[model samples]
Target: MMRRQFFLLPLMINALMACLAMALTNITTDQHALLAFKSQLKLDPSHILSKNWSVSFPTGKWIGVTCSPRHQRVSALDVSGMRLSGNLPSQLGNLSFLASLNLSSNSFHGQLPKELAQLHRLRYLDFRLNGLTGDIPFWLGLLVELRFLNLRNNSFTGTIPSSITNMSKLQVLDLSNNPLQGNIPEAVGSLFNFYP
Candidate 1:
């Protein structure tokens, strides 16, 4: 009986280990998404996220990162006002779980990456006060969860995509300072009038 119990103990331990491994895998994927975003964006020069960055266990407490409890997945990335310069990285799209992304008040210049449309969970995106220019990617309308979108004080130009109307959850839309032209989408006026 002692030998039989010993054999069963190993089987149970192996099963438990397998379950733990699966959970860790899911957590790692989430963490990777956040880390990828951090790596893609340009950071400040004060060694803030400059060196010794780790996305696992107790290390994420460094700076410019906010993570969840259990899996340590990043939820918000607020790297605003850092004067950082670089093109918005396409890798940012990997952060599908991000709720808020604030790269405002920086020197970032480039067309908005189309991949950003993949952020289905993003609620607030503030790219105002940057140097971003080009036709606003129509893909942005795909962000169904977005509420506050501030692209003010930038160089974005071209007709406002009618797709902007797809953002049903949007509450605050500030494009006042951009170079966008053309008649405002009628759907937008019907849904929420900005002018009396």
Candidate 2:
């Protein structure tokens, strides 16, 4: 019994090390993605991200960033009402573990990046009161986990995508104040907690 136990010990240690290495790699990836996002911000009026989001500090410790206790990965980011102005970066889609993202009441402009469709775990997304334009991406429906979606007070045009009904978990959807055409999808009414 002692011989068998000793033989298995090294194998178990090696396996544990491999898992740790993979976790570390994922952590680095998240940090790089955040840095790339910060690079595109043309205006950070309060210097919040500019001073806090840096290699000098851990990514999870950065302001507005939240890390998951179990996975040690970024799970939420809320920079709302910061008055920051810039185009959304595609790098944000790299946050594979992100569940909630709020950037409301900012000056962010430009079309939503299709890369965001990669965030399959996303649940709450808020971009209200921004200057974002272009037709709302139909790919948003691909985020099957979405519960709250707010794009109000933006300059989005075109009809609301009927594909939005694909979000079976969706509860609140605010597309109001846009120049959208066509009636809201009849299927959207089926959503039990839908808010027009």
Candidate 3:
């Protein structure tokens, strides 16, 4: 009996360690995503992400990070009013669990990345007051969970993609202040409470 117990103890310990490792990987991936954003986007030298990003603690303690208790990974990133300038990186799409991303009131330029469509869990995306240009990617409609989308005050041009109407859960849609032309697609009315 003593010999059997010893063997079982090691197995249990190994399993516990595996679970802990998996949790740590998730946290690391989430943090890496935020770091990638900081590197790709030109941020104001006066205001920057926390330098102590290696420490583990409540996400609220970290600048621009928000996490949920159920899953200790980052859920939201609000970097508004930071006076940031630069183009977004395509690598941002790697964040599979991001829910809200707010980078408003910055000076970011370049075309909106098609990679952004990969954020399946994203619900709120605000890129307002930037210099982003080009057609709205059709893949954006694939974000079925999206509820709030604001791309206002940008240099975006071209007809709004008809696929945007597929965002059935969307409650607020603000594309005003861009150079977009052409009649608004009829399907846009389908979004429950979408407003200009």
Candidate 4:
């Protein structure tokens, strides 16, 4: 019995260490994605993230960053209205655990990076008041967890894709003030039961 207990104790310790290593890897991955995003910005007038994103600050303590308590992975990033200008980088797709993101009221331009569709866990996204162009990517429908999406006042053209109906979890979808034409999809009825 003594020998059996000794072996089992080491096994448990090794398993615990492996889990800690994985958690650390996840935290580092989130930091790398955030740093990659900062590198692409043309300007950060408020110096929010630019000044605060450092290892010494801890991933969860960084400005506009929020991490999952259990996994220690960035889950929400809200950096709205800091007069930032830059193209959205594909590296953002690396934040696999991201659930809520808000980059509204910035001057970001160019097409939305297709890599954004990699965020399968995303629940809330607000990119309003930017200069983003191109048609809203139909791939957004693949984000089955998405709930609130606000793309108001952007330069996006073309009609909303019918694939958007696949967002059965979507509760509030704001696509107002774009150059979009054509009628809303009929399948949208499944999303909201009441509408005024």
Candidate 5:
């Protein structure tokens, strides 16, 4: 028994080291993705995130960022009301574990980044009070885990995509005060917690 234990010891240690290396790699991937996201902001008057989300270390403790307990992957980003003005970056979709993202009350304009549809785990999303234009992407329906959806005060045009009805888990749907026209989809009323 002792001989077998000794033989397995090095293998176990190697496996442990591999796990640690993978964990470090996961952190580094998130850090690199976040730094790419930081590069997208065209404006940051107070420098809230511009300086805080640093490359020198892991970023879970950064001001508006959060990480999962198990994998330490970035899972939330809330920088609402920061007054950042720019388009949402496609690199943000690299945060595959993100569950909540709130960039509300900023000045981000142009259409929502199509790449954001990759965040299948997203549960809460808020873009209230932005300068965003273009149609609400029908692709948003792919986020079946969404619980709270808020786009209350943007400049989005065109009709609300009927596909949004696919978010059966959605509780709050706010599209108020936009340039959107056309009838509210008949299915929208079926959301049990939907507010008009």
Candidate 6:
């Protein structure tokens, strides 16, 4: 029994090391993605993210960042109304655990990054009051778990995609103040929670 226990100790230690490595890697991915986003910003009027987002600090402790207690991964990022101006970076899609993202009342422009479709865990997304252009990507429908989506007061054109009907869980969808034409999709009537 002593010999068996001795051999098991090494195996247990190796397993613990592997778990720790995985946990670090997960948080590192979130850090790298956020840094990439900050690098692309054209303006940070108050240097909120400029100074706060650094390798020296834990991401969860950063201003406007929220991490899940169980996973220690970034789960929510609300940088609304900081006067930030930039193109949305594709690296944001790397925040695999992100559930709520609010970038409203900023100066961000450019089209929505298609990579964002990877955020299957997203529940609340608000991009209102920006200069974002281009058609709302149909891939947004892939976020089946999304509950609230606010894209009001943008420059997005084209008709609302019928694919949005896939978001059965969606409760609030505000697409007001755009230049979009065409009627709302008939299939959207099935979503009882949708308020348009």
Candidate that scores best on TM-score: 6
Q: How many backbone clashes does candidate 1 have?
A: 0
Deviation from native of the Cα of residue 141 in model 3, angstroms: 0.5
Q: Lowest lDDT 10-mer window, candidate 5?
A: 49-58
Candidate 3 structure quality by residue, lDDT tens digits, 1-196: 9999999999999999999998888777777766677777565655556463445655456777788777876778888887888888776786777899998998989987788898999999999998888888889999999999999999989999999988999999999998888999998986786765
Query: Compared to the true structure, candidate 1 yields what TM-score?
Result: 0.78
Top-down TM-score ranking: 6, 2, 4, 5, 3, 1
- Model 3 bad stretches (over 4 Å): 1-18, 50-60
Q: For model 5, how does the per-residue alpha-carbon lDDT over 8-98 read when each residue is reduced to its tens digit?
A: 9999999999999987887777787778767888999999887788875568779899999986799999999888888787878878899
C-alpha lDDT of all candidate models, in order: 0.77, 0.92, 0.83, 0.89, 0.89, 0.94
Model 4, span 65-139: residue lDDT tens = 999987778999998988999999888998999999999999999998888999999999999999999998999
Q: What is the C-alpha RMSD of each candidate to the true structure, in Å?
A: 4.2, 2.1, 2.8, 2.3, 2.6, 1.6
Error in Å for residue 31 of model 5: 1.7
- Report the alpha-carbon TM-score of model 6 versus the true structure: 0.93
Candidate number achieving the greatest lDDT relative to the actual structure: 6
Per-model TM-score, in order, reads 0.78, 0.90, 0.84, 0.87, 0.87, 0.93
Model 1 — which ten-residue stretch has the worst lDDT?
187-196
Selected candidate, larger TM-score, 2 vs 3: 2
Estimate the overall C-alpha local distance difference test score of candidate 3: 0.83
Error of 2 at 91 (Å): 1.2
* Root-mean-square deviation of Cα positions for candidate 2 versus the true structure, in angstroms: 2.1
lDDT of 6 by residue, 61-130 (tens): 8999999999999999999999999999999999999999999999999999999999999999999999
Model 4 scores what on Cα lDDT?
A: 0.89
Candidate 2 off by > 4 Å: 1-14
Q: Sorted on lDDT, highest at the top, how do the candidates line up?
A: 6, 2, 4, 5, 3, 1
lDDT of 2 by residue, 1-196 (tens): 9999999999999999999999998898789888887898889988999999999998889999999999989999899999988899898998999999999999999999998999999999999999999999999989999999999999999999988999988988999999999998899898765655
Clashes of each: 0, 0, 0, 0, 0, 0
